[model samples]
Target: MDITQTTSVATQAAASSADKSAAAISSDFETFLKMMTAQIENQDPLDPIDSADYAVQLATFSSVEQQVKTNDLLTALGTQMGGVGLTQAAQWVGMEARVAAPVKFSGDPITLSPNPVAAADEVNLIVKNSQGVEVQRQPISVSNETIEWSGVDRSGTPFVEDTYSFYIESKENGQVLATSTVEAYGQVTEARSQNGGTILVLAGGSEVDMASISAVRRVD
Candidate 1:
């Protein structure tokens, strides 16, 4: 099913659950009230029940009723929020999201955003294949905001089409300082709600949390 339909069904389920809980709470409350009334009416006239005892009973029931109502309202609010999130996430489909993860390469150059350490004097791009095997390493400009990777190997040959990861290896005085993955843009093919959060599926069928997306843009 599509995202919108899936979310609607989920919301309906939550609403039904809330309705059932409210009904059960109401039934229990009515029974409590009826039993209390009967107790009061059948109390011995000479030794009538203490007014303080009745007050305590009423106060306790009132608290329980209030708590149940509060829970019902909260459940409804959560359902509403989930629907809103799914609606927003559905709009992200067909767009390109910038994230730090492996991306599938199919002959087209991929744009990468490298973040190198500030203290490093040199930075190199490290390319790894799906199996985490290093395939290419080349020096890159430190000040470049974005780089279009040609998906080529060190021997100047095009790599076989597959999922690949890119990293920025920062060095100072020939000593490695830090290595961090670079963000790349990938088309978002699907979106869904999982564990109360939105997840986006990229073109390669990889799933990423919506919160991890650094930027989005329409596919050129």
Candidate 2:
């Protein structure tokens, strides 16, 4: 169904699998111990099993048990971490975040953080739509500053409210100096976990990984 529903199902399935695995391991261990006891009891009196062999078997069993316990603990820890992630995600719901990824332009002016190369004499901000088509381009200062886009095309015509990406090109005397990294500020509308990681769903349907967020601030 929806992403949130899918994530919930996945989490439940993982917890169930962990529980089943722990149960199976415990059951198998009990069977193994019983089998070993039967072997020792039915051993020949004159040709008894070597004490060294018994010790080795016991050691192996202990190792397996320890490994199973470790797995159980790790599984529990993962579940706990997932809960903590959800709690943190809930806190991000109404806050603005600067993420190192493309952003959605919803007719409102969006702020972009651009980092220009140290030696660059000129910097330009390139705006691209979801289809990777350049819609607007403008010169910017060669400094680490935030630029705002009015969601308009070159002709001053406003672009339809939708998701758009941005890129920054730094040049020095017509030669390309660097293509700097761009960060977009957006509001987090929702959050979901997929593939063992948290993803923030922003306004205008853009999604970004929680780890990709560089900064967070109140949406005043």
Candidate 3:
């Protein structure tokens, strides 16, 4: 018979139960009774099977029934936990986050994009360390959308790998012009099982899942 057509866990348990009942009472319980009677009639009557063996069969049936119910309960719990994880991912849609990152900033090839499109003259970028010390000053010549720097100092020396902010200025009179705007880039802080798998949103603008991440960083 087809064994997997049952609906509810109770129904599946019942079907398995019926199959076991059929095996326990193969052709008929009456046939077993009749055969036992005939065997008793033909035997010497002192070597008959003990009555306790039948009680053992009843105990086995009870154990199997309880096992099927327990399995069903566990399956339900797994489905519930998966739903809870998805809900947590939804809560991280707009939160700001910084992800794990291996920074690869070469002081010799540092370049930043142009903020104001119209002003395409020479702009100066001043690099300052965390202690507010002026470390490097270079003239960034802008012609198009981005300003490319050779990551060199005023004396044409390469910069060391560290966190620093730049102050862009007008190269004519050496006055500060435009400040920098840092953007957040990080991995998905959350995930969920949507139609099938999951969807994720980073701290910035990109919408990716748990799998699309290569690295994370918070560059200001």
Candidate 4:
């Protein structure tokens, strides 16, 4: 990932290319070994190159060869993972998704979708703040329906421009009933791997970790 490592990789790639281009490189490798052995065998009686020095070069070459192979395998695995993410992206096309985003206050009532499985009979929406404090609560009639928020706080004060969270609940006979789920909806712009997992980035500048996905649909 550093400059020196990148340069080393480039150098190794050039070496690999050269080795492949020289079709008889394996025979050449054997020839060099034989020549070295023959020279040592015929060396003068008084002077000889150190056999230990040749042994060191052989060891270094072996390590470098293995490293080049490892790099190639890793590059191949990355390509495979990218292909898998593309296949998964096609699964989320037409399904209605409930993404958690604050409804922009335009004086229009906010509408929530896909009612809770627990208490879908009498639905209610609870708005919470960043601190998880319930700032507003309103009773609604449908679980899988949408309700607009006027951006007003519990005391009927117009809320400021900031992010908020909402939870849909169902209550019957003054008792809690069920809870609904919320999901974000958008086209998958791209899929990428991060921290060993794939993430799908949607059209609204929001990112969804693949593990968080609950449903998928195909659309034209």
Residue-level lDDT of model 3, residues 2-64, one tens digit each, is 112212333455456656655555444556557667765776667765667556654665576
Residue-wise C-alpha lDDT for candidate 4, range 1-220, written one tens digit per residue: 5323433554465556656644444665677689878888998879877879789867876676666666656655554554465455545543333455432333434435545655346667777754567777777666454555666766778865444567777677667776544542334555555655666665444576777765544423
Give the candidates in order of lDDT, highest first.
Answer: 1, 2, 4, 3
Superposed Cα deviation of residue 39, candidate 3 (Å): 13
State residue 120's C-alpha deviation in candidate 2, in Å: 1.3
The sequence of per-residue lDDT tens digits that candidate 2 reaches over residues 1-220 is 6545554766687678878987888898889889989998999999999999989998998898788778877876786577567668868998988986667776789888998888899999988887888887799888887878788776789998777788899999999987755888988999887666788988877888888889988987
Q: Best by TM-score, which number?
A: 1
Worst 10 residues of 1 by lDDT: 75-84
Per-candidate alpha-carbon RMSD to the true structure: 2.3, 3.1, 17.3, 9.9
- Give the per-residue lDDT of model 1 (tens digit) for 1-220: 9766887788788889888988988899899989999998999999999999989998998898889888877877887787787788789899988999888888899999898999889999999988999988899997649989998776779899888889999999999999999999888888888887788888887789988999998978
* Structure candidate 1, residue pairs in collision: none
Would you give me the overall lDDT of model 2?
A: 0.82
Could you tell which candidate, 1 or 4, scores higher by TM-score? 1
Put the candidates in TM-score order, highest first.
1, 2, 4, 3
Where does model 3 exceed 4 Å of error?
1-48, 97-190, 194-220
Which candidate tops lDDT? 1
Q: How big is the positional error of residue 152 in model 3, measured in Å on the Cα after superposition?
A: 12
TM-score for candidate 1, residues paired by index: 0.87
Supply the global lDDT for candidate 4: 0.58
Off by over 4 Å in 4: 1-79, 83-97, 100-111, 154-156, 184-192, 200-207, 211-220
